[model samples]
Target: MILVIGGTGTTGRIVAAKLAERGHPTRIASRHPSTEGVRFDWYDPTTHPDALRDVRAIYAIPPVGEVDPAPIMLPFLERARSAGVRRVVLLSSSAIGPAGHGLGMVHARLGELFVQWAVLRPSWFMENFVGEQPHAVSAREQGEIVSATGTARVGFVDPADIAEVAVRALTDPTPHNTDHLITGPEALSYDEIAAVLSEVSGRPVKHRAIDPVGLAARHTANGIPPDFARFLASLDTAIAAGAEDRTTSTVADVTGRTPRTFRDFCRDRLRGDRPG
Candidate 1:
């Protein structure tokens, strides 16, 4: 059976659905127990045992709100290994290296523990414009997308692409045992993203670059912890330094198909209407 951690989330939900469509024995793990899955919280060890029962493979999405997730994840992964789980596919970020902080540490550890593992280091999700994040959606509504990224570009990948790659990694007999730098078809700046939103939504949209201090203060006001807020702001600062402006072919190589472009995403999710 395949255990999909964070299965109700953006990429996880799609991964679970695709596995189900393929007639794979799949179990979804979430914080809340549901008819569809079991309650599995990484911070809570009691839930881990039940979630790992009869599961052979896992799609692991680390717990949110923790900058350094190794403390919370390493123990559970050790338990999973003990439980006879062999394969693991981790959802990580493209910006973080194997020895870097946060999820990078988790990625490094995964390689040490499991031979049957693939780390998906995907670029920023295109869903950030149309999904839960306020910046891009607010741009469609209020004509301005605010960011600390300045004019830097990102190869914004689609969540569907990430899910597809995750499924391949989970089911493949031979493990990749390497990091796949997943990206969209092209790199684009926030200014260009705003222009695309304007064309797709038929609205006048603009990109507004903010200072890191102001961005941190805004996140703090929205109830995020000070340290994490600063960390998030720093990501944008890195982007402004030209950190995330590259594309890769790993998506196509892994999934046997080209990754979707930002234009394709806008056409499907943003065309002829305001972002929800």
Candidate 2:
């Protein structure tokens, strides 16, 4: 059976559903036990065994917002390995590299721990702008999207595309055994995204750029933990420096299908005169 960590989350649920659709024996790991998921929590090691029971492979979404997730993740991974789990698919971020900090540590460890593994480093999610997320809420209620990215462009990707590739990595006969830097079809600036939102919703939407310090302060005021809020703000500077101004064919190369575009995402999610 394939154990899907964080199975109730954005990409995890999609991954679990896809695995089931393909007739794979899928076990969903959640803090809340349900018919669809098994009880699991990263902070609680006692919950690991039940989730790892008879599992062959794993799709790991490590502890969120951890600048250093190695401590928690490495232990659990070792436990999974001891429990006979073989292949592992890690959901990493494009912002974090194998040689970089934070999840990068876990990224490096996965390769050493399991020969059959794939690391998915996907670009920023398009869903960040179409749901109840801060960006979306601000766009709807305040008529603008706030960021510290300045005028830099990012290869904003769809979660479904990421999930498709995750499914492939988990179930394929031959392990990918490498990291996939996944992205959408094109790169776009937050300014251009605002323009698209304006056209789709027929509203005067705009991107409100600010310094990382200011953004961090705002995020903290909005109830995010101060340290994590600062970390989130810091990542925007990487974008402003042109770190994400590129796209790749990893999606099509892995799934043998074209990944969806931002415009396509806007059309499908943002509708009914809403700013979604």
Candidate 3:
């Protein structure tokens, strides 16, 4: 059976659905057991064994931000190995570094584990456009998207494609112990993204530049916690410094199809109904 952590989340939900559709017994593990799935909590180690029981494959979605996920991930890996799990797929970030915080530590360590593993290092998800990022939706309603990034272009990937690649990796299980740097087809700036959103939504949305600290405050004012708000603003600063301005073919390379373009994402998400 396949167990998907964060199964109700963006990528995990899609992966679990696809796996189930393919005749695999998929179990979803998360803090909320309200759904018809396994109830598991990362903070509660006692629940881990019950969740890992008879599981052969796992989709690991570590907690967000630069927090230490090793304590959670390492135990899961050790237990999976002990339980005779065959395959494990981990969702990693492109921004992760060997010495950086957050998923970076987990990503680096997952590489050394004595099991068949695949790490997906994807760029900023297209979901951020309509779901996560306040600027994108605000732009649709208020006609202006603000960012600290000016000209830096990012190959914003779709979580759907990331899930597709992840599903393939989980079921197929070839070329094990490899990291895939997934990215969209083209790189575009927030200016271009605003234009696409405007066209898709039939609004006059524009991109506005804001100072990093000011953006941080705005994020907190909009409900993000202070520390996470500062971290997000720092990420924008990283973007402005050209940290995430690269493109890659890994998405297509793994999925046997081209990654979805931002325009495609805009049409499907910004214009059409999927989910928030």
Candidate 4:
């Protein structure tokens, strides 16, 4: 059996569905016990035992809002290891490395605990345009997207591609004990992305670059925590410094197919979903 943590989340939901389609006995773990699965919370220790039951593989997502997830995750992973779970696939970020903060600590620890593990460091999701990312949706509605990234570009990857890679990492016999830097076929700036959305949806959209500090303040004003808001803005700051402007072949190499282009994502997901 496979246990999917954060199972109802963006990538987790897709991962669970794909695993189910492939005949895997999948159990979803979440804070709420809404589905036919287990209730699991990283901050709550009592929830771990039942969730770990009869599970051989785990799809793990670290608790959000913490600069270091190791305090919440390492203990649970220890329990999982003791309970005979062999394989683990972690959903991490492309910006984090072995020495970075937050997920990086978890990534380093995963290597020490499990011999069979894969870390997926996927770039920004293409779904951000049509889903929960406020800037993208706001662009569609108000005709302008705001960012601190300036002209820097990102090779935004598809969630489906990330899910497929997670599935393969979990079920494959070979232990891909390495980090996979997943990305789209091409890099695109926020301006280019806005142009694509405008063309696909037949609407006028523009990219507005703001100061990183101002962006952080804006996010804080919108109810995001001060530290997290600053951290998020820092990602854009790094992008403006040319941090995320790269593509990778890991998606094609692992999934046996090329990563979807931003144009493809816009065509399929944003073509008919224009803002009212």
Q: Where does model 3 exceed 4 Å of error? A: 131-133, 272-276
TM-score of each: 0.95, 0.97, 0.91, 0.96
Q: Is candidate 1 or candidate 3 better by TM-score?
A: 1
RMSD of 1: 1.7
Q: Which pairs clash in the backbone of model 1?
A: none
Error of 3 at 29 (Å): 1.5
Cα lDDT tens digits for candidate 3, 16-114: 899999998999988885457888877788888989989888899886553567766787788788888877888877877654455676777765665
Q: Which regions in candidate 2 have their CA more than 4 angstroms from the true location?
A: 273-276
Off by over 4 Å in 1: 272-276
Pick the winner on TM-score between candidates 2 and 4: 2
Could you say which candidate leads in TM-score? 2
Q: What C-alpha lDDT do the candidate models reach, one value each?
A: 0.89, 0.92, 0.82, 0.89
Candidate 1, residues 1-276, lDDT tens digits: the string is 999999999899999999999999999999975797999999889898999999999999988767889888988999889999998999988878887567888898887778799999999999888855777657756788888998899999999999999999998778888889999999999999998888887778899889999999988987899988998898899889988999999889998999998888988986546535
lDDT of 2 at 216: 94
How does residue 230 of candidate 2 score in lDDT? Answer: 94
Clashing residue pairs in candidate 4, if any?
Answer: none
